[model samples]
Target: MNETKEMRLAAINNLIKFISERGRRFFYRERNRMTGEPQTAYLKLKNNRIYFVDAYTSKEVYAYSGYPHDGFSHGGTLWALVCDFSIFVRTGKSSNGKHGYGGLYSGDWGHGDEIQEEIINYAKEIGYLE
Candidate 1:
């Protein structure tokens, strides 16, 4: 199955709605600061933009920032991910053949249930319907 523009928009809208409805009041994560432990508030999305309420204590982190490659490479990385998933049933990796999410996926970070489910549901709803 392939995703249409409408399907992609729907998925994006669903993700936004899910986050808006059940994101968090004040989510926190452990951080390191000099000698004492610090608690960093989770990032927030407002009007489709990300913000940090507790900016001084928070750090920007990407789970796959250094996975198989540096994510910052300017080769349309996210578009490639979307294209491979939207068009093909597999990434040609025999070890994990036919799993919807393909080669470039990193394991989920332990943020909790809501975001994880939101990701999976959006994927399926957008035509990765495995």
Candidate 2:
């Protein structure tokens, strides 16, 4: 599979707003056994797509195609992480970003620290952290 995905800057910005306004109440996390600390996370869906944010890294957000039957079906959305915006999803019996990149991997392509930071701030601005 050699499919590339892209999300416009405006759409990306809108996603942040939507999540902040309606998703703040659903923020959740799991404790990393090694560190015994809880990481922050949030998920949002729109137009048959999911926007996942994992603050554990550079606080980046990735967009993935929605699940066939389950909205939260497993997979990675690292399409935007690389300069080429190349992304792919594999079939796996898992779910969420913690699923080892689900099926998406780009060999350390690149990540947008700016966009990543913006998402986190937007979530907080809408009181997702408060």
Candidate 3:
């Protein structure tokens, strides 16, 4: 079924709201600098933004400097992801269907079938599917 762009965007945003409201956290794979042992932490989100102080430790593994990817956040790259999902629902095609994300995506930034899967699955889980 096809849906409007605005509708899809709203659904996506709602899913994010659901997560943030629950105070849910995610972890990134990181190795302890001092002990050389890998560990995970509950990455914190404050006021709709991720803060370093929110994490259990100051050190974060697999940190990104500028933008976030097509993952579960709403930032630089997520804007594109939202647009792509909207287009897919409306047009039934996402950037030629070659790549999961829309337009010219690169692995360096936001590009992966995993993100697409996350979006679809989460949307369905949250009753965002249309």
* Better lDDT candidate (1, 3): 3
Please provide, for model 2 over 1-130, each residue's C-alpha lDDT reduced to its tens digit, 9 standing for 90 to 100.
Answer: 1221233323333433443334231222345333556643444344544455442331334454333122322223333221111122222111223423422122232335554455555534432221
Those runs of model 1 whose alpha carbons end farther than 4 Å from true positions after fitting are 2-83, 86-107
lDDT of every predicted structure (CA atoms): 0.36, 0.33, 0.38
Give the Å shift of residue 59 in candidate 1. 24
- TM-score of every candidate relative to the true structure: 0.28, 0.23, 0.28
State the weakest 10-residue window (summed lDDT) of model 1. Answer: 89-98
Model 1 global lDDT (CA atoms, 0 to 1)? 0.36
The per-prediction tally of clashing pairs is: 0, 0, 0
Clashing pairs in 2: none
Stretches of model 2 off by over 4 angstroms after superposition = 1-110
- Candidate 1, residues 79-128, lDDT tens digits: the string is 23333432332221122222334433334323367665765566455444
Which clashing pairs does model 3 show? none
What value does the lDDT take at residue 6 in candidate 2? 30
Candidate 3 stretches with Cα past 4 Å from truth are: 23-122, 125-130
Best by lDDT: 3
